[model samples]
Target: MHVTFPGRHGADPARAVDGVDLDIRPGEIVALVGESGCGKTTLARSLLGLVPPTAGRVTFGGKPLGYSSRALKAYRKRVQLVLQDPSGSLNPRHTVYDAVAEGLRIHGYGGDEQEAVAQALSRAGLRPPERFFLRYPHELSGGQRQRVVIAGALVLEPELIVADEPVASLDASVRGEILALLLRLRAELGLSALVVTHDLGLAWNIADRVAVMYLGRIVETGEVERVLTAPQHPYTRALLSVLPEAPGDPVVLTGEPPDPSRIPSGCRFHARCQILASGEAERAGVADACRGEDLPLLDGGGRAQVACHWARAVRT
Candidate 1:
């Protein structure tokens, strides 16, 4: 889906999310990997109905998402957002019980509120749920606070969870626990998730599939094992190259990321692509295409795909 915003003053509009197609299957997790300003969060917001796409449509269960108040309310019940920071997500005045129950209250759930809250908390790994009911945010550890955030999303029993950097704020010791909790939740609840993160390691740990984003588009996508082990897109390779586990020197990309409002001609990533810089595109006979021909969108699908003219030439 596409989501563009009006430009500041008289400049071109910022194409926050341009021509992106992604799908999430039930009981599966898909990680969106990209730099900070590459429109990962905008895509997440669009999926959750927070921002209406300026050009394309968002579909859920084969139906177009509606923007009406009632429609959005119903949609939100089945899809929830897990923010990056738990401290900011939870209120200092609210106790764990109140925090988790808030979704039920807003949705006007007719079931047993206390029971639902307890069950949600239990699912999020906060065992002996009742013991923490009265505890406030300040009393909880970083991991516990995050669990509470997860519990709040779970309280509504959502079909999908859009977690934006869920463990980015936690200590290295606690990151694994939270990641494990997410995996456990999917296994037990049959929940689907769209995890937006910049960390390839996080994707390796939790996602079944990975979609690499560049500018406002998805440049490459495939099964996690395939994409991580043998990346095709230049951007994806550069990102994985910088990983602590990567071999040799990292492929340090030159120049700043292109501005969305003035996205370059041909491939948006061509400006800083290592393949183009190292004459690989020229060797593959697609150097001109790399600078002049825009490639098709690499729609998230079963098979691996890369939106790069050079890669396409070399593969063919």
Candidate 2:
């Protein structure tokens, strides 16, 4: 999928999501990781139908997404969004009960509204759901507010939840609780999720699979263990190398990611690629290709793949 916007102040159009492909299966969690401005949120928005891709299409249940208001409303019932900030996601005045029931009311649910709200709250790890119904957002703890957000999504009983930085705003201790809640929800509800985050540690802990994004495209992907522990792409390795538990010296990328409006040629990551800079590609006889050959995009399937001329040449 490709999502672009007219460039700022009459510059070229900025490509927020460019030729990216990803999939989320039932009960599975796929983490999309990258630095800020790497287009993770845009990709998630495209899947949520808030931003239509300028090229390609988003599909759910093997069918193409429709942009009609009715179809989108129906799709939203099956796929919900859990935003990054609990403080911003909830209204200051809406009680917990009202907040969770908002989706039900909008969708014109015919079932017992109160019962559904209670079940969703309990499922989201807010046990004894009735006790929190009368409470306001300011009255709850950060973790609790996040739970309420999850409960909002849960109330819809969605097949998939596209969470954008689910725990980034919570306390360190609270992050684990929220993550555990998501894992438990998947186990008990068979729910799938596309978690957009920059924290590789969070992805390593919760995701079944990981896709590393660079600029606007996936540079590497595999099972969490393989991708996090044995990253093949220089970008993935650079990210992991800075973790507290990671071995070796950190790879400090010199500059911010290239502006999407002016993505570099060949490998989008080549300019900052440590492998090429360290002469590894030269030894492998692909240094010239690294500067001139654009690696093929990943098929976005369930297999290990790395989009780097150097990595591919070494593997072959």
Candidate 3:
């Protein structure tokens, strides 16, 4: 899917999601990783048809997404969203059964509602299902609430789930459990998922592939092992450098990312890129390209793709 959003106010219309091209194959788990406000959520929301793209198109099974209510409703049945916060997502007054069954009701599923709800709850790891049907959101633990949220998505039996920070609100142990559950669901049901998260650890834990977003653009992408172990983009390297398991001096960035409305020319990351600032790019003879020419994501003819001229010149 390719997605872009218009800039707000009268500022320059820098795309919240620039000209990005990404794909999630069947049964694949692709993590969209970045710092906060890097437009990972916007890209994820576009997949769910929540935020329509100002430019570019999102296609499902080769068909372009439509804006009609009926078209959107049908599309939603196939693609579901699991929000960052279960507490904020779930209605306090609604019971577990109501929350899970709402999608079925909206889609007018004629199947047995009780059985459908039970199966969804079971699939989400809320074992036995019946025990939690009458319970409210406030009564459930953080993990359980997240499970309930997943169950709600499961009720639609979607082929793809766009999870925005699915485990960010849970305890450390619970985060693992929830991630494990997502993995199990993919294994059992062949479900494809687009997980939006800032945690590289989470990407390393569950994603089959990782796309590192920087200021609304994917700077680096590849198989999880390749991208995390040998990141090409300086932004990606800086991110991995901070991990406890990484062996080396940390590559701390010097400045904040530029505002979306006021994005820099050429490489969006050049302003804070240590490689360019340290003269490595100049020594490599790619400084002019890094500072003047827009670098599109270039496939390395291997497992990884990167969008920086310096990364291409130095690593390839």
Tens digits of lDDT, candidate 3, 1-316: 3454455685566567876788888899999999998888888888788888887788898899998999999999999999999999999999999999999999999999999999999999998899999999999999999999999999989999999999999999899999999999999999999999999999999999999999888888999999998888899999998988889999989889898878788899999999999999999999988888998754322358889898778776
Span of 10 residues, lowest total lDDT, candidate 1: 294-303
Minimum summed lDDT over a 10-residue window in model 3 is located at 295-304
- Between candidates 2 and 3, the one scoring higher on lDDT is 2
User: Which portions of model 2 miss their true places by more than 4 Å?
Assistant: none
TM-score of 1: 0.99
- Give a tens-digit lDDT track for model 1, residues 1-316: 8899999888899999989988899899999999999999999999999999998899899999999999999999999999999999999999999999999999999999999999999999999999999999999999999999999999999999999999999999999999999999999999999999999999999999999998999999999999999998889998999999998789999998899999999989988988998998998889889898988887767678889898778788
lDDT score, candidate 3: 0.90
Model 2: per-residue lDDT, tens digit, 1-316?
8899998789999998888988888789999999999999999999999999999999999999999999999999999999999999999989999999999999999999999999999998888999999999999999999999999999999999999999999999999999998999999989999999999999988999999998999999989998897888999989999999999899998778999999988899989988888999999999888888888889878899999888888889
Q: Against the true structure, what is each candidate's TM-score?
A: 0.99, 0.99, 0.96
lDDT of 1 at 33: 95
